[model samples]
Target: MGKRDREILKNICIESVAAEGNALAHVNGKTLFVPLCVPGDIVNVQVTHKKKNYMEGYMLELVTPSPMRLAPFCSHFGDCGGCRWQPIPYDKQLEFKQQQVVDQLTRIGKLDLPVIAPIMASENTVRYRNKLEFTFSNSRWVPFEALRQEAGAREVPPSPAPKAGHQSAPESAPLPVSGSAPATQLPALGFHVRGRFDKVLDIETCHLQEEPSNAIRLAVRDYAIDKGLSFFDLRQQTGFLRTLMIRITLTGEVMVVVVFAHDNPEAGEDDAARKALLDYLQHTFPQITSLHYIINTKRNDSLGDQEVIHYAGKPYIVETMEDLEFRIGPKSFYQ
Candidate 1:
């Protein structure tokens, strides 16, 4: 084994934050790994293991701090795992991410690269995500204890109606129910917790996505649950609904695709269900221009082999940025 392969703890000053949100520091003839650290942070790290040309370590303590550090927005910041740099200021995070990209090109790519250009800032840092996917899990990861209290109130006994003598509280119409159960909460739509697919974290609002995207996500989940659709089990890979995909254009056009694991050639396609989903989406969100449905019998997450058998409108959506216009289909990659 090479000398660098031996594990050794060391104190090092962090130079900058890396792309995956780990702090970067070079020890005496070794590399170190520190989590939740940013640039200009002087820390003491304990080496966990040694690699051929580098070392892996955990942050033991911080000696100096970076001015760019800021409080993370999400309550599940370190635990939930969807975002890595939420604690760092957005502008500073962008700078660090860009620097990491440039460093990879120069140091790892071994190319005589030119001076890196400034990073292009996203138009809407909040509510900018065009796509999101959520799963139906038996258990949920509630960020705080207060969320449980709110959920319990929905199930508890109702308060008495206002007395006849007192001015009656403004009467509110009852919420429509699908099938037998009331609608599920909206913020409950979210990604799986880090390292735990069976456990889902309920995100009340995500700043990354557009507003309509959240509405569509909640609606689809409600529809599927009402129809008694089964959510996919990642471990067993057996279920009716495997994944939900949403595509949106810069011009506000929306397309939704729901993937199923099994195909019912005999049952054929359910036109009514398709129409209901499409109609609900169109009526609720007029910005949608197209919608599609895909079925995949494969046991894995790869969507390459999936067949898109149905489409509601145009097969693709167009996005415009500056003078460039790009055509995006169900399988197109985002810029």
Candidate 2:
């Protein structure tokens, strides 16, 4: 395959944004993957890399705006990387996404299926997300360029520390430091950083899930950090806490799954830590009807092997959709 590197600024009209967040466009008989673009948008894109079959680009300017465009509700719209269609009106975004699925199925899948139909729009656009996973790493937090520019004149500095090894000055010894600076405010709750899992943008509020879902995520993150719980590393497959999974049902039932790379002293040490977490969740968030701990020993991404050894409530959470009740375990898929 031939590859070329060029900076070609052209008026690229986006047909749709793929599921993975790449805006698809046909440029000079070659497919282009443009970032931060939506369907119906006429943008000035700079081709950064080129291949025999496709090109990759960055949006240079918005030459012609799409009527579907709207002011994103989230302040961290471009930065969080969770909801790429936030800029496009929610209804329009769903319409385009459905169209994208139909296009790909007909074009790539080559399946002579029936005419693609419109997707059933989500009932609650904001706070509809029932699951969220946040990563932790010792790296700098970088927001999207657009967000940084918008917050140009107004930048807030990091909060002042309470001094190392000193929790309350003439009182406690800094709360017994355990793991890496206490997580420093759960890294954004929205989505993974583009092309980087270790990096995450802080999402203040998201409109994709229930409001309580976000609140529970942030609260749990803070609680874990205060408890000095470690976040897991997917690349290295090391860390005390690998990931946090939250499951909620239409009946206002909540379930939390705390996954670990390996067992911790609390969980392993007579299951004290695990019990404590369950107790806390039950006491603090009475809405939580189920809680589980998943221990993943494998060094791969297939979570199917991971087993739930402990449970605070029922083994699975039941979600009702289209008059069908789906039983979701700790290792189940959202869809």
lDDT of 2: 0.63
Lowest-scoring 10 consecutive residues by lDDT in candidate 1?
A: 172-181
| Alpha-carbon TM-score of each model against the true structure | 0.67, 0.72
- Top candidate (TM-score): 2
Candidate 2: list runs displaced more than 4 Å: 1-11, 15-19, 26-29, 94-102, 105-122, 136-140, 144-190, 264-275, 321-327, 332-334
What C-alpha lDDT, on a 0 to 100 scale, does residue 57 get in candidate 1?
Answer: 60
Write candidate 1's Cα lDDT for 139-203 as tens digits: 34553333434655565334344334322212221111111113343223467765565556655
TM-score of candidate 1 to 2 decimals = 0.67
lDDT agreement with native, every candidate: 0.62, 0.63
The C-alpha stretches of model 1 lying farther than 4 A from their native spots are: 1-14, 26-30, 41-65, 133-189, 192-200, 265-283, 323-326
Clash count for each candidate, listed in order shown: 4, 15
**Clashes by residue pair, model 1:** 127-207, 127-209, 129-208, 129-209
* Tens digit per residue, CA lDDT, model 2, 9-54: 5567898776577788897798889866767888766566778998
